[model samples]
Target: MASSSAPSSAASTAETFPAGTPAAAQIFTTVLSQGPLTRLELARRAGLSAAAVTKAVRPLIEAGYLVEDADTEARPALGRPANLVRVDGGRALFLGLKLTGDQVFGVLTDLRCRTLLARHAPLSDRVPKAVLASTAEMVRELLTEADGYGVRVVGLGIAVSGDVDRAEGVVRYSPFLEWREVPLAELATAVTGLPATVDNDVRALTVAEQWFGAGVGLSDFAVVTVGAGVGCGLVVHGEVVAGAHGVAGEIGHVTVDPNGPPCHCGNRGCVEAIAADPAILARIREAGGAEADSIDEAVALARAGDAHAREAYSRAGEAIGRGIATVANLLGPERVVISGEGLAAYDLFADQIRSAFAAAAFGSAARCELETRPLPFEEWARGAAATAIQSFITEPNRP
Candidate 1:
């Protein structure tokens, strides 16, 4: 799970992503996400003329970022077989890191966001300097692995659970880590010598889902994560919502019961206060004088038919469900993805979650599909890589 070896000196230079113009970047993204498309289909999906797509793709293809090939499997009944275009996954590499309170999860991914390697380092300290050293060491290990593929690692992305200013590459606040005003991106870049991007962990996960996982091709959806802390990531009108102050979709802080429990954000009965892993454990301990050292232990106690443990899980589920309904009512998303390490105990609370969601959802909002996905910390790291890929292709258009 970890290594004590110090990081070597950083790489001097890296390759650049080829998409420069917004139109070109948009076209590349279309192919990267909804890829292996014919020129006609790419043009149609991108809402651009064939000539425009061709012009945009030319530079990308020349740069080895895009590849064209015959779709023998989908060879038409008509005269000619159409060539499908797709991103070249081996063209460039990126490093992504998910920083948690106790550990750092990292991954090496290609241009198309395919994970090639993964590593983690235990975090005994939460200070910026310590975390940065651990992060740099992890990136060094990953970059060494990348050397095998004969490709340059172009960027590094760090996903932290907090209010992150992606545009500014700063972590404004991180309650879990007790950090404030940390210039994470600059520090990371200085350590690794790669362009670094910092973003909210859940929002970074949403970006990965939008590009490659459950939320692909869906314009309106929400990703609600339950675990040590409850978090939500929202996508509306095909863009992740960052809000005016770099914080949004914070359903975890929504007050589900005005008198339930105290939240770290200074609110009573907030969803996270009742539904987060620590909260469930605390409730179980309070109800019957039982002690669960970890969420897994709490799950096992509930599964063993302990009444207090079961009741605690039920309460957590209800709080989470209400928070989800709030999101549905406000956004009317087409789907909501419920995920995180907490899903390991989903069976214990599944019914309560559904029942509460059904009762609280407003009108047509109740019609929204609810999906449960189990994504480990590694996937969250992959999400961080996706953010790096996004910045790489669209940096020119970024404000």
Candidate 2:
């Protein structure tokens, strides 16, 4: 099941999810993800009886979260045409924020997790206090824009890159921000006056993909993001695994080359130590004795046919491929999605990634499909909103 917290205080006055049982959450999620479904079709997809589906959907429809309409497109040939059911996207609004070391990205979304507006601000400081201030300002901007929609923004989700405890609304550690044990959700709620959820950025992105993007309908899959970090999010048996300690998919820290460069995690040759942007840049500088200030510069050098730069990217790809192979060999996911800002340099190392994976993967694991998707920062912010939507609907009412 998706990890979520109870609705925040800001949602107290808003119309809460009427049905609190897990069955109702499941039924509503089915319609939200794959909807306009007939009651029979919904029951079949959700693995629930027709009566259970009806029972679960009643309160949701009455609360205006789900709506029914005539099946004009595919009316039944039999007696009465079945009505199609879908989530009412405009019923409520949410806010999502993606926190990076140097910038903060935000998006406003409705109940269906559609990005209605996006805004971003630069971060001059990584201090938790400064970040909270920036987040509050960003929230204010989004809320101001949301005012035009005539809907209340009920919850806020903050996606940070590192270990996050979503249920507790805390940032256990965010390497990019150099933060440790930051009670981000509570602080964000205090500053922004909205309920908050905190989650790992890549995992949050996986939620968006699982519900609305590439991973939709896939029972078992992985989302491997390559950029400042090489992060993975695993969905096993149709549920995103948070693991026992909330660090299930730290594929970045997986050892790919024991003798390779050191990582911030104080390890040698971890995937992130080689495949991450900083690592790639470090490699370019070390190999060519040229200071490539940014990833763009490194990509440009490779694109211009610089041997050292191209070789650095190739090595990164190889490390990434090996890491992916490990995930496949262990979990045998049906598909592995390669995404993130690093995809901008994919052309430089695409072949190496493919060949390395092909060589390292064992037997049936090699059958796991590999595909690349380039999702922008705003899309990641929208993912934060998806978490808020999940929290709002799935969390049981508090005593």
In order, candidate lDDTs are 0.89, 0.88
Give the poorly placed runs of model 1, Cα more than 4 Å off: 1-14, 76-79, 396-399
Q: TM per model?
A: 0.95, 0.95
RMSD of each: 2.8, 4.0
Of candidate 1, the 10-residue stretch with the lowest lDDT total is: 1-10
Summarize candidate 1's per-residue lDDT along 1-399 as a digit string, tens digits. 134333333232445667767889999999999998999999999899999999999999999999999888887898778899999988888889999998999999988899889899899799998898888788888878778888778777889998999999999999889899999988888777788889999999999999988888899999999998999999999999989987799999999999998998999999999999999989998887467888898999999988999999999999999999999999999999999899999999999999999999999999999999999999999999999989988884332
Clashes of each: 0, 0
Task: Report the number of the highest-lDDT candidate.
Answer: 1
| Reference-based TM-score, model 1 | 0.95
Provide the global lDDT of candidate 1 against the true structure: 0.89
Candidate 1 residue 93 Cα shift, in angstroms, is: 0.7
Model 2 earns a TM-score of: 0.95
User: Which pairs of residues collide in model 2?
Assistant: none
* Colliding residue pairs in candidate 1: none
